[model samples]
Target: MIQETYPMTVGGEEVLSERELLAGVEDGLMMDSTDSVRYIILHCSATRCDRDYTVEQLLHDHRARGFRTIGYHFYVRRDGTVSQHRRLLEVGAHCRPFNRCSIGVCYEGGLDAEGHPADTLTPEQTDRLERLLLKLLRTFPKAQLRGHRDMPGSVPKACPCLDCRNVFRAIL
Candidate 1:
């Protein structure tokens, strides 16, 4: 099997591949302490696969919804660029009621071309999401990985559009 590589930018420097990202995670340079964290909830932007959702659009959309900023702690783009929109220690507005003790990770796309719920995670997104979750796990050993829909009190919606358990089965 061939090893797929993708570009990533962490802290302003461009990381050439997933290998380098893993190395940084191993070095514990990319994550902050989150002793209060009990869950790492995965989400999606609920956008069609053909559309591009930029950071500015996300901020604007969230702001329009009365959010102070992007609610998720991290936002992973289709090309695998992970943005730290909120700090690890900060309480996110994503996943209500559990925001104070959870880290919200949202991927870019979740809808198919016709605008229905589907797992539209690009290869780059899959890799980046996995690595990001791994790093978070290492930083907060007790934290459990969960889908937004899996949490109690979540409304009936396909926010993430996939079963994180099966997608990240290797690491989980």
Candidate 2:
């Protein structure tokens, strides 16, 4: 089931697409046996759109912050490359409190050149994100999608810098 439909290059090395990683989930081989997922939380790296944040940098940053690995289940690069850093069934460390019942999908940018919060999602990212969300909805039909800042008890900060509700209001 690991079709090489989407080709991607990570750090000058060719890597398989996120689709290959999700094949298990697609076939029911990978799923939360307890069905604890209640939310699909979206986040952003909060890096400037002008800068490139590679998956390696993300892993390093998270590990430096005491995280065992990147907290997000999927990391979408600015080029629309989706990298599955964690398993779908594994509880993410992306958002506090909601990690136990949520899947975290993160994009690479969320700030402008001035470091101000802004929706810097590239056209490719927007397209891929919507496609990914559609697939996720197929798997977790009951999960509610929300932006990182929109979650209850979230700190007052613009981590994602976009209104996920409005972005996918028509689709969801």
Candidate 3:
């Protein structure tokens, strides 16, 4: 049978409630629920430096790039530390119009700044990422999953990683 509840626990405890992502706890809004979730965009940090940037750093950097928030709804760190960067309720800063509809979960690494494969997005991370995506898909049933590169003009070099798309496709 399909699971009813999504995975909300991290490090074996409730974590989603502990976030101040998006506006705050007071950001009163709800995403429209339907039998299907339309899209899931795959992305990577494209940084080869290895766990050098903190969540706050990413937020600051993206803001420097002129986004209102950190962009992605969730970020899976190198250590498998999942951070709620933006609320699933609000429109995200990730993929423009697609951000409003798609749930963006970024793997910590997959490609270097040059879009070349690196020793990134480890096996543990891959497992957790798959579990997280599967969980999210159940909650948002209309999740017609895909990648950022699949969209028009999404990257300078069809960025993110190479096999990341293949991975998502396998799961979806």
20-94 per-residue lDDT for model 3 (tens digits): 322222232334654323777777777673446678888888766545467787888777888886666655666
TM-score of 1: 0.79
What TM-score do all the candidates reach, one by one?
0.79, 0.79, 0.70
- List per-prediction Cα lDDT, in the order shown: 0.82, 0.79, 0.64
Question: Candidate 2 lDDT, tens digit per residue, 1-172?
Answer: 4445546553343435554333212221234543677788999998998999999999888766545468788999999999997788777777777777788899999999999999999999999999998778777767888999988789847978999989877668
Ranking by lDDT: 1, 2, 3
Model 2 clash tally? 0
**Tens-digit per-residue lDDT, 107-131, candidate 1:** 9999999999999999999999999
- lDDT of model 1, residue 3: 38
Clashes of each: 0, 0, 7
Index of the highest-lDDT prediction: 1
